[model samples]
Target: MAQPPPATMRAIAIRDGGWRFEEVPVPVPGPDQVLVRTHAAALNRADLLVLDGSYTVNPALAAREQPIAGMDGMGEVAAVGKRVPTTSVGDRVMYMATSAFADFIAIDHRLLMPVPLTLSAVQAAATPSAAITEYDALIVQGGLREGQHVLVLGAATGVGVLATQIAHYAGAATVIGSSTDPVKRTRLDRYGVHVAIDTRRPDWAATVLDATGGHGADLVIDHLGGNALVQALSATAVGGTIVHLGHLAGRHAEIDLDQLGRRRVRLIGSTFRTRTREELFAIAAETASALRPALTEGAIAPAVDRVFPFSQAEYAAAYLTSGQAFGKVVLDFA
Candidate 1:
C-alpha cells in the first residue's frame, strides 16, 4: 500500500524576483483529480516566461503569493479521487499541468497519460508537452498527409525535434529542418530530418525549394517567427499550411500579403494558453491515440539533451537559456 502524502512539499516557485524552493501545502485531489508523486519534471521555455512575468496560462497563478514554475512532469499515482476510475494508485503517468515543479501534483485524471513502458520517468516527463504540441501542430492544425513535404524551423529545439520525428512517423516524403547553428544542424538528421538547412544563409529558402524540386514544403511547422516567418511564405508550396508555434527569433513580422494570397497559403497561430479544460482534454486524448503506437514501440521518443538534479534547476534553466541543449532539458528528482 502507498504511504499517505505529507502535508507540505518542496516546490520551485517565484519569490524575491527569482526562482526558489519553497515549502507549500500538498494539494488534495478533487473528485475528478489524481495526486501524482512527481519523479521528474521537464523545463520548457514557457517556464522562463512565467518567471519573468511575460506570460501565464493560469491567471490565478499570478495572484498567488508564490507561483510555481513548471508545466509538465511524470510520476507514480499516489492517490485517486472518487470519480477517476481509469487511473489508480501505483499507475505510472505523465501530464501537462500547472504547478508541476513540485514533488506532487493533483491533476484531472483525464489529463494523465500512461507512461510508455519503453520510457524511463525522465524521458516520459519530456514527452507530454512536446509530443502533444507537435501532434496538434503537425497533424491537427497543419493537416499533414502521407508523402507530403514538411519543414520545421528551429528543428533543434525541444518541440522542433519532436515535430520532425512526428512528421516522419506520419509518412512525410521529405522532412526538412532549419537551425542557425551549424553544429545543431548536423544533429537533426538523427532526429528524422532528411535535409538540414542553416537558416543563417540568406538563400536558405532557395535551398528548401531546391531540395523539394522547386515545389516547396507542403506543411511548415515554424518555431521562429519574425523574418523567418516572412521567408517561409516564399518557401511554402501552393496551398501549404504554416502553423506558427513559437517566436524564438522575433515576435513581429512583416508578411508579404501578395505572396500569401497568390500561393493560397494558410498561416495559423496555436497555443494552449487560451484553451478551455474540455478543449485541452480533447487534444490530450487525440494526441495520445495518434502517437501511442510509436511511443510504445520506441519508434518515436523525446530527444533528452541533459538531465539536471532537482536541486540544480536554476542551472538547468540557465543551460536551456544559453541555447546549449540540442533537445529537452529535464530535472530529475531521483
Candidate 2:
C-alpha cells in the first residue's frame, strides 16, 4: 500500500473536563488489527455518561477505550496487520471501537466484519455495538423463543428498534413498544412493532397488560432504567425474563422482590463493549446473519434522524440530549 499521508486526522477528544476537536495522529493498525477510514460514526446516550464521568468503565479499559468517545462506525480497510488475513486494504468493513468518533480508527481484525456489497456505508456503520447488545440481551441472555410475547421499552432508541426488529424476525407472537412521545408511536409499524403506546400516558402499562391478555409479556427489554424497570416488572408474567440493557431513564430503580419472588422474574444486565472477544464475535455473527435479509429488504436499517458533519460532534451529542431523535444521530465523516 502507498504510504499514508502526513500523519494527522481529525478526532473528537475528551480531556481534562471538556469535548474538543483536534488534529491527532492518524491511527495505524497494530499487529492483528485493521485501519478503518471512518465514513460515519453513530452516537449513543452512553457517550454523555462517559463525558460526565458518570458511567461505569474499567479504568484500565478506558486507557484503551477513551479519547475517542463512540462505539460504532463504518469504514474501509486502509491497512492490515500480520496474522490478520480476515481483511485487506480497500475492503469495506464495519466494526465497533471504543473511540470511534474520528475520521479513522484502528481495530483488531477479528473485530471487523465484511460489509455486504449491497449495504451503504451508513448502514454498515449502524450494525455494530447497539445492535449487538440487543442481540445478546434478547437472543442470548433472555433466551427468547419463537412465539413469545416481547415488550420493548424506549422502542425508538437505537437498541430498542433493533431489539424489536430482532424479536419480530425470531417469531415473537406479540411485540409491544413504548415511546415517551406520541409522535414516535406512529412509526413503530416500520419495525414490526405490533403495539406502540405512548409511555407517558396514564394507562399505557394497562394497555400492555391487556395486549397480552393479562398473561403479560414473556420477555421485556428495558432501556429506560429506574421506574421503567418497575413498570416492566408489573407487565411481566410469572416465569418471564426482563433484560436491562440501558439506563437512559435514570440510574437507580426500585424492584419489589415480593413480585419477583412470586413470579420468578429474571432481570439481566447486558453491555456489548465489556464482553470477551469470543462472546461478542459470536453474537455479532448470529445477529448479522439473521438480520441480513431484513436489512437487504429494508425492513431493518439504522434510522438516521440527523446527520452532522464529523467536525460538529459536540453539537450532535447535544442534539441527543434534547431527545429530538427517535433513532440514531450519526457523525458524518464525509
Which regions of candidate 2 fall more than 4 Å away from where they truly are?
1-5, 57-66
Give the whole-model CA lDDT for all candidates, comma-separated. 0.90, 0.79
Please name the candidate that would achieve the greatest TM-score relative to the true structure: 1
**Tens digits of lDDT, candidate 1, 274-326:** 88778888888889888989999988899899999999999999999999999
> Model 2: how large is the Cα RMSD against the reference?
2.1
Judge candidate 1 against the unseen true structure and give its global Cα lDDT, from 0 to 1. Answer: 0.90
What's the true lDDT of residue 161 in model 2?
Answer: 83
* TM-score, cand. 1 vs. native: 0.97
The list of candidate 1 runs beyond 4 A from truth reads 59-66
For residue 3, give model 1's deviation from the true position in Å: 1.9
Evaluated at residue 327, the lDDT of candidate 2 is: 82
- For candidate 1, the per-residue lDDT at 112 reads 82
TM-score of every candidate: 0.97, 0.93
Candidate 2 global CA lDDT score = 0.79
User: Taking the candidates one at a time, how many backbone clashes does each contain?
Assistant: 0, 1
